[model samples]
Target chain A: EPEVTQTPSHQVTQMGQEVILRCVPISNHLYFYWYRQILGQKVEFLVSFYNNEISEKSEIFDDQFSVERPDGSNFTLKIRSTKLEDSAMYFCASNAETQYFGPGTRLLVL
Target chain B: EDKVVQSPLSLVVHEGDTVTLNCSYEVTNFRSLLWYKQEKKAPTFLFMLTSSGIEKKSGRLSSILDKKELSSILNITATQTGDSAIYLCAVAGGGSQGNLIFGKGTKLSVKP
Candidate 1:
């Protein structure tokens, strides 16, 4: 079965530096989403995208965060300035009726 | 804010035991409830419940939703060590994006 895939399975970055997490959702899936989970915490929604535009976002998704579907397949989340609290597992998902998730990119901001 | 709550944060069960995981939610424009099994890196989709009373099943796992109560339950029958994982419940609502609000999750450890 086709599945969502993410790049840079693991990343380590200095605080205040920039990092971009990338994902390629399942083919034919229309809606895309980004969510993060701090260690031992619930998965929190960051933003949702459709038609190459943000549909909705959470308070956690602030100016530092941005998402883009730069191409037909690539969906990316960019953190302009990383913080210690930015360390988490970032997941990208897509859906037709039910959402499917990628393997996830584990971000570690030092 | 839209929120989800799961019960029995953690559970331990022997092989062949049956387990029920609970999830409740409060949100505007409730769309659907989904269950996922998280082993490590990412959550794998399990079931999506939209209508109440109807049950969705796959192998030994089954789930049902209660719209009136705004809750859902995931039941695993004839469990095995492979059934061990954190089960996450998420609600999609409030907007058309279907953005999810997740519960803390229920960790199940099925021992041999």
Candidate 2:
């Protein structure tokens, strides 16, 4: 019954500024991932994390993006400098054979 | 390129109607196909299909994977207004990065 949780359900930031989206994946899940959905586009993978290292990443996950476990429970995605195109709903998912998603953080870069 | 594609980008049906959503994929070393219901924010997990022929069901929802055809289908019978939402199909498999590839999704609207 446990669900992945994210902080700041919504965020509005100025372009070129730094932002960090936080996620607390299900306690026992092994693999963690970050995905984004543009208003009318398909959900796209950003990055995947396991064993405290990045296992895989998409082209969208450029040098500006970085992910860290930080601790036992928190997985964070930091954007070094935001861009208008970066506005989207970011979801944090945890996989345990099957994947479960968080409610998502709506990021708006203006 | 490895990708997932869904059909009938949008659908509208009466409350008592039945609807079948289709998803086809061409993912490399396909491992599993997953169905999710996205209402507003979070995508609620519905089912995961790995093998072909065998069906996985839950209540009014059922899904099956056809590896040979490189596709899958989700069936919702006796639908209700609450069934309205976007259905997403995603595939995961071999290659690097163990990430899921998603389709644009099918938008369903069940009217009461």
Give one digit per residue, the lDDT tens place, for model 2 in A1-110: 89999988999999999999999999999999999999999999999999999998889999999999999999999999999999999999999888899999999999
Q: In candidate 2, which residue pairs get closer than 3 Å at backbone N, Cα or C atoms, i.e. clash? A: none
Q: State the weakest 10-residue window (summed lDDT) of model 2 chain B.
A: B92-101
Model 2, span B1-112: residue lDDT tens: 9999999899999998989999999999898999999999989999999999999999999999999999999999999999999999999975454688999999999999
lDDT of 1 by residue, B1-112 (tens): 7789999999999999999999999999999999999998889999999999999999999999999999999999999999999999999999788898899999999999
Write model 1 residue lDDT over A1-110, tens digit each, in one string. Answer: 89999999999999999999999999899999999999999999999999889999999999999999888989999999999999999999999999999999999999
**lDDT score for candidate 2 against the true structure:** 0.95
Candidate 2: true interface contacts recovered: 0.89
What are the clash counts of all predictions, listed in order? Answer: 0, 0
List TM-scores of chain B, every candidate.
Answer: 0.98, 0.96
How does model 1 do on interface RMSD, in angstroms?
0.7
TM-score of 2: 0.98
